[model samples]
Target: MKQRIAWITDSTAVVPDELREKYDIHVVPLDVIFEDGAYADGIQLSSSELYEKIDHSKTVPKTSQPAIGKFVELYEQLAEDYDCAIAIHLSSQLSGTYNTSKSAAAMSEFPVEFVDSQIVSYPITTLLLKGISLAEQGMDYREIAATLREEASKNENYIVIGKLSQLHKGGRLSNAQLIVGTLLQIKPIFCIRNGVVELFEKVRTEGKAFRRIMDQLDLARGIHKISQVEILHGNVMDKALELKETIKSKYQDIEVLVYPLSPVLGVHGGQGTIALTWTNEPKSS
Candidate 1:
């Protein structure tokens, strides 16, 4: 009998809809809760809906991972079809989803290997996409999972907030700084280094921010081999499209794909923000 393998990831991965179905990837949706009500991340608040709601939200939207029981149930069903299952998730430091995934795996009656990605959005999604390709190629589950862990640990999440208004509203940034940024027309540049989001730079305009991000992209490695570039945004279609064009113009050959930032991320990135999700070369390695 041929060996079988299964792939899983959280909603924050920002996977393209067509690829999800094409790869048969199991995407567990995150929970988006408003004071009025709650709904599944992708299913309930489509990308368009998420953006619309974000612009009008007076209160911060809450996010929750899939419960242990839900994880166990999904694992049980998939385990029956596959000889081994590999579950990948966001940073354990950022969210409890990774821990919950591991806990559910331990409780499962079948073999469910959980991987802590330590990265979010496109970086994690890229790892998952690569892992799924390996699995589909008849690689062993352990090999695929180990490769994903290695790649994910080295992935860099470079995010650019076209406006600080969203981060300020979410309380991630102070009101005073937010006001100054607004007056100065500041665009905050950030990147996830060592499992945490760190400020990269502060630009006075959004146009320069785009170039700065692409300049960083040009400096980075590992992206040339990877054909797909994932763009995650919060209520910023025009900005996303413009950035996509910028990427194509500079790279000339590399294709850029945009995916809506899930509600889990919407909590941190305010409306009208652009997050470039891609992997980078380790300075040490």
Candidate 2:
């Protein structure tokens, strides 16, 4: 008999609704806490709504991982029908969601395998979609999980920060650095390395930062074959579309997709932030 596997991911992953429905991928949401109360990311509050609230409020919101009990309940329900589950989440370095999921999985009656994507946003979406394809090709649950973990390492991510205040508030930047960066109009390009977000480069302007991103993409293409690229933004569709057009003009064969960053991510990135991400073509196993 074939083993039945359930696909699970957190709200930070950007799986399309149709794809999620077709693959039966389950998503657990994180919470975004405002001054008044906490709202589940993508549940009670959307990315637009989150931005709107931030615009009106004096304080920036904070995000929290889902409760362990929530995962336990989900596992309990899945235990009835599935043989095992694969839960892919954002980087452990970035959020505690993966660790919380692990604890919940341990308490559940069902077996659960976890993939710490070591990344976030559309890259997580890419990993989950790739795992589903691997499973469809007759790979077992364990093989699929292992494959996803390996693929997670190949994801290349870069972000252009839109607001310096948010990073300072989040403790990613110091008071001195913030003041200098603000004074200089420095737009930093950040990348995920070894599961932690690191400053890749600092350019004097946003336009210069974008040029650096394009240059990075050129270098990546020279080294590896990239099939698809995703441009994610925090309520900045116009800029995302402009970047999409530029990429398309340069690489006609590569597919490009644009998506809104989840509210959980927006809280950290702030409005007008743009993220560019892609995975090198998977090597034959």
Per lDDT, the best of the predicted structures is 2
User: Per-model C-alpha lDDT, please?
Assistant: 0.76, 0.91
- Residue lDDT tens for model 1, 190-235: 8877677788998878878888877777767434444457788877
Q: In model 2, where do residues sit more than 4 Å from their true spots?
A: 168-179, 282-285
Candidate 1's TM-score reads 0.89
Total backbone collisions for each predicted model? 0, 0
Give per-model TM-scores.
0.89, 0.95
- Candidate 2, position 154, lDDT: 92
RMSD of each: 2.9, 1.8
> Mind giving the per-residue lDDT tens digits that candidate 2 earns over 17-54?
89888989999999999999999999999999998998
Model 2 TM-score (2 dp): 0.95
